[model samples]
Target: MTIRILLDTDIGPDCDDVGAVAVLHALEKLGEVRIAGMTHCTSSQWGAGCLDALNRFYGRGDIPIGTLTMPGFLDGDSGYAKYNKGITLGYPNRYQTEPAPDAVETMRKVLAEGEDGETVIVAIGPLINVMNLLESEGDLYSPLNGMQLVSAKVSMLIAMGGHFPAGKEWNFEMHPASAAYVVAKWPTPIVFSGFEIGAPIHTGRSLTADLPDTHPLRKAYEWYVGEGETRHSWDLTAVLYAARGHHPFWELESGTATVDAQTGANDWKHNPNGNHAYLKAITSPSLVAEVLDNLMTR
Candidate 1:
């Protein structure tokens, strides 16, 4: 059976998110997964447009795209808006003019519509949207609350955040409170693909070299890392493991993970029965990059 995936991303800040979406689309075309929905956790106005443009580029233009509506998230003016602008301007996007629904509401609707224990959520962004979803009360979609709905529908959460045994990462640090809350209270098993797992595994050069200039993936990589240059496959790693379970590429270390809400610092303690686990690289970075690049350029 193909895995049903709901992607939560902050696509504007990093080009890796675009690569990640491309990887997901590639797997989708191969009958490995179905992209149920996409949500952006950033406040960037162009976020939904970027997502919609990329989905359209992959010929999945009808996929729903939602954006973070909650206040106090990342700003609309991000340094990476240039790439997002390029995508929205250059590609065919419906959301560029139509406003997207709230991320929390979109997530709730998707989860409610999903089969029990079948939806895998790949979050490659800040935890704000997720935190809001978890703390949300029952709505029209389902009577079950956020945590209950997640426990019922979600099989696993594959998150690309944090640094290994200890340290801070961008996703976690961007919204520390949400990270802390989600880490402490999330109902399902979460597998984190940490910074160390993706940092050395570079990609994008192949995508830019092979894909046409009109392709959003090529444009994103070209503008972010320059033409024929590589970038870390951070978000792509999470989406990869979410679609295909860990085997040849990685190992898992089960532990209790904690993030200081104030500082965004993270630590892990070994616990055989813990619901949280972080990925440990087993395959060489170059090999993994080859796998990801092939998928991206496919």
Candidate 2:
């Protein structure tokens, strides 16, 4: 059976999300997984359009797209237009003009359609969207509240955030309140691809060489890091592990993780009843980089 994945992303901040989406589409093409839905958690208005363009590029244009619509969520523009204007302009997508549905509503609708304990949520961004979903009440999409719907539908949450034993990271720091709330209140087992796990793995050099300039993925990389330059595969590793469970490439360390809502720092304790775990690299970073690069280039 193909694994169903609901991807929550903050695509405008970094180019790695582009690679992550490319990796996901490659896995889908291989019949290993299916996209359940996509939710954009950033304040950027261009995120949904960028995501739609990517989906269309990968030949999965029908995938549902949603965006955060909370007032004053990030107050100012999330700078998505500045970061992803190239993508939205270069690609053909209707989301550029017609906005996507609310993130929580889209999340609820997608979770409602999944079998109990089946959908895997791959969050390669901030936890704001997931936190809002957890705090949301029942709506037209489903009678179950956020917590109930997640408990009934989602199998696991694979997030790319935080630093190991104790430190800060971008995804966690961007909105620490949501990170803390989700970590404390979420119903399913939580797994993190922390900063240390993906920092050593550099990719995108091959992506520029392998894919044509017309490819949106290639263009995203070019826009972010210049032609043929590499970036750390933070989001790519999370998606890889989310799509393909366990392997020698990485191992899981079970522990309870806590986020300091104010500082956005994270700490882990080896609790006996801990429901969280983080990825630890076992295979060489070079080998893992090769694997990810191959997939992103596919």
The digit string of per-residue lDDT tens for model 1 on 123-171 reads 9999999999999899999999999999999998888999988999999
Candidate 1 deviant stretches above 4 angstroms: 76-78
Q: Candidate 2 lDDT, tens digit per residue, 71-178?
A: 555426644444477888779886777878888889999999889998999999989999999988988878899999999999999999999877999999989999
**Which pairs clash inside model 1?**
none
- The lDDT of each candidate is 0.90, 0.88
* lDDT for model 1: 0.90
Candidate 2 colliding pairs? none
**Top TM-score prediction, candidate number:** 1
- Model 2 C-alpha RMSD to native: 1.5
